[model samples]
Target: MKSLRLIFCALWTAAFVSGCGAYSFTGKSTLSSDVKTFTIRDITLSAPSSYATISQEMTEKLKEYYQRNTKLKLVPQNGDISIEGSIVDYRTDGVAASSGGDKAAMNRLTIVIEVVFTNKFNEEDNFEKDFSFYLDYPQNQTLQEAEKTLVPKILDQLVLNIFGDTVAKW
Candidate 1:
């Protein structure tokens, strides 16, 4: 009876696993099977107020995100999937009012990136869109001081959004 129960459990587990056909824990199923590689062109710094390193940082961060999350290999040029874009906007503005209502209590730094994603295997999935994110910091902190911590967080979210749009389709 124990042996029979073990066999039954094995059969049930197999059935459950098979039921998940095309569903992957990493969300790779959304990408066509032909998509085995990807490429990210240089992301230009088009925003006049944006610092120079931001463009390069964003490009590298995106590459790293895809490498970590997907099985696709990184290529130099055209691949199964391609991504290119530029920093369209970068600015800081007061988001919250101070107790006196005369000054800002918090400031928000926002970054907007224009992205063009192309899928060779699935032309319908190609898209050109803008993804943006922001971080709020105390008004007392200078942009430079807050940027050291805030920029990374903003970039992380932007990358995630881009990933969702281009690959995860979520």
Candidate 2:
């Protein structure tokens, strides 16, 4: 019985080691090595409005994500990696037109962001990209409040999308 226990332990250790070597979390490890610390500069707003505050909120959330999910640290100034960008566009349009060609019972908010990710070490070309997101607002709800609620959720998804595309290589 002791010999059998020993063999089982050996097999388990081997399997664990092999698993670590072979495993890859596609969207989780893209910047694993090139970036040790990251700095997200203030995001520029396309048009001035209450939404301007959303930019700073997004920066903080992204920094938190990196801190929690990766080994990367968040630096105040120059760091191995940096992200800077602007809010390029913001618009609200009607969704689902009515039979009379009028705006229907819902509206859509579209936010577009232009971003650049730089590798200070010159490990690769700077990444410049644009991404957008849309959310439907019920006709009865206040646009202002809806906008406020959507900002964080939109920022969260945008962060995931940006990181996955540029760093995660997804």
Candidate 3:
């Protein structure tokens, strides 16, 4: 009986340790063992054609984000999961009025992205939707001056929303 109790305790400890490894602190992933790879196609810019590099930057940012957050392999094509999106809108609007005039004191830079996510393993989880975010800047700051700092912040929010929808399903 003493040896049996020792064996049972050892088995329980092994099972608990292995189970803890299956949990993720970030986004939840319902991916099966066979669904191991993903593909993110080139993101297009339908918003402002003048900023030619925006699309490429967004694409690279998202790819790098997924690589950092998930264990899925990045594939060129025919992956178990696929994400394709476009920057549909990029514009600035006045949000806060000036202290003593009709002029604006603060402006908001908004970016609208349209994403389509496909899960080959579970067709029920597929979706196509718009993910948009914004940043506020003082009226003194020109859009050009703000673009460098604001674009990344906006993209980060969009990435988080998409990640939640795909993995966490929230």
Candidate 4:
């Protein structure tokens, strides 16, 4: 019985180590061994709205997310993985109206981000996708009040989706 337990433990450890070697625990990336660096070009603001900071904030946040979660070096160009795109939409609409139907009870703010990810080492994984997310707030609140709080929250999910599609293999 003791020997059987010992063998089981050994097998489990071996499988976990081997399985994890090809992927990052956080990003869940199955990055090629030859891949060493990554690049993120400036994201453009294509959305026709007053949320001018979306592009800048998204670019910086994506850079930081990859830098924090991956082992790859951040290069200006010619990297193993390259990413770029735009903020394609910034929309707000009433989600729910008051019982009287005279005023909105809740409003939603949505952001759309489109990205093209190229994996030079594995061209099969290259893709262009649009990631979108939203936040709901009281209709009485001004966009200025809701914008500051909602932008980052929605952007976080958008970044996560992009990261997952590009590198996480999820």
User: Which candidate number has the best lDDT?
Assistant: 1
Give a tens-digit lDDT track for model 3, residues 13-132: 999989888666654655777778899999998896325578888889888888887788999998898999999999999999998778889999999989999989989878999999
Superposed on all Cα atoms, the candidates' RMSDs to the truth, in angstroms, are: 2.0, 3.6, 4.4, 2.5
Which is superior by TM-score, 1 or 4? 1
Q: Which stretches of model 1 miss by more than 4 angstroms? A: 1-13
Best by TM-score: 1
Better of 1 and 2 by TM-score: 1
Tens digits of per-residue lDDT for model 2, 49-70: 4475877886777777767776
Per-model TM against the reference: 0.90, 0.79, 0.82, 0.87
lDDT (Cα atoms) of all candidates against the true structure? 0.93, 0.77, 0.86, 0.89
Candidate 3 residue runs with Cα over 4 Å from true position: 1-25
Better of 1 and 4 by lDDT: 1
Please write out the lDDT profile of model 4 over residues 1-170, one tens digit for every residue.
99999999999999999987755566555778688899999999988884758888988999999999888899999889999999888999899989999999999999888899999989999989888899999988998899988999998998888988887877
| Clashing residue pair totals per candidate (backbone < 3 A) | 0, 0, 0, 0
> In model 1, where is the ten-residue run with the lowest total lDDT?
24-33
